[model samples]
Target: MKNWNQQEVEILKSKGGVIALANPYDNLVTTGVEPWPPAEVVQKLYQSRQTRAFSEEEKEKLQKFNGYYSDFQSIHSEDAITWSVFGTIARAQIEKRNKFISELFQTLDLESEAVESSEIYLWRRIPHPDNLVPSGPEIDFGILTNDTLVLGEAKWKSSLGAAQGKNKDKNQIQLRVEFLQKYAPKLYPGVHNFVVLSVGLNNDVTENYTGKTVKCISTTWGAICCLQSHPHHDELQRYLAWKIKNTKNG
Candidate 1:
């Protein structure tokens, strides 16, 4: 029997937990898949049905058929681990920026609301999107909505190294367009934007990104921005405005 003690619990877990084993569907990891481009990830999954850890019978099933797909496995998938690390750190930085920006703006007593609703996911690791959803490979960060879809990639570094491995050739960033084309077609139903934020620049890389209708942008916080949890907004004009003491200084 499939352990009726936790049948209900296992059933619920079984619904989707399989990916956790095969793909580690860690949603919030919530950031980069590899030093290389996430689009490079390509493989077929192989396994017998039934979750709750591989059982003897399930192992037998895998060996019984033993077809090409049977042995199919991801020996080297995209660095889902790195992506997860990047996402978690980057989102935290975003929150920090939001706070700093909000605190700075609040002092002026401005009347504007910044929505704090956005999800970051460790997306690129999946062989395919969860439950065969119509999502795409704009991984690292690809969130979609009614009007606009934001495809974000977060790059991180310690800045302690003499050299860093960034897509200096602009290869991965360039492939992002293709990543969109292949992974999540639905996100591109209409308009979209591409964002690449790096902690530091690679040793010999140039910043050359392209797309016809895509709006591509980078951050002002320099490449070392990763080391700082919170970043000052790069608008020197705005920073200068804040520099002069306001009538109210807390």
Candidate 2:
């Protein structure tokens, strides 16, 4: 595979940002793949099933299964391209765990003491804090070290939510930190939250973590895309380039 030059990366950062981080259904459409059944169709099907439900157990199972399916579709659809990029990087990290993570941390400008082993886990849908809250928000990506828990939310052509409301309540990142302090003490004692955007023109990606509330650092998908330039990642690089080219042409 040809080496990716700065020019190519810049082009991708500009024209291919949307394609690189497109929703799964949109990705398929961009690539000329067939669209899924419409939202109304799926809703109608679910409603019909609900109208002729079976026993309590069966109904519970149906609802659960439907929810699971919805989540599956969402995960696959919403962040398909972003996941593709991260998934390839994860695979490479598995091969060169220590080196890969060290470089990755540096790329993201993460300062750490020391970690014996690290793990990268994706698609974390943290449970709600209390019964009052029906559902909890999700962490787009996570990196777990021996003592540190780094969670990141990635955005493309969208602004990160700084605060939930004008009243100045905790922001989304702060809420996650609060949850970790309350619930995930044993799992991840230390937490770091970051947000990666497609265009990080004026965004702050610096370390702003303090106390139990970690300030979210903003970065760009293009910066992380640079990590996939290794020879071992040739296949993924080629694939991404090919897709980006197609997307641009279209």
Best by lDDT: 2
Worst 10 residues of 1 by lDDT: 1-10
lDDT of candidate 2 over 1-250, digit per residue (tens): 1222322321112222222211112232122112444332243223322213234433344344334222112211324444445543444444465555666667667675455676765566676543226356566667676555666665533355664523456566655666665666644545443322122323553335556334345665445546644323544354445544543232
Worst 10-residue stretch by lDDT in candidate 2?
10-19
- In order, the Cα lDDT scores of the candidates are 0.34, 0.44
lDDT of 1 at 211: 55
Clashing pairs in 2: 24-77
Error of 2 at 75 (Å): 15
Candidate 1: regions farther than 4 A off: 1-85, 89-114, 123-138, 141-170, 181-185, 188-191, 196-200, 203-207, 217-250
Q: Which stretches of candidate 2 lie over 4 Å from their true place?
A: 1-78, 92-95, 129-134, 161-171, 181-187, 190-215, 228-250
Top-scoring candidate (TM-score): 2
Per-candidate TM equals 0.32, 0.52
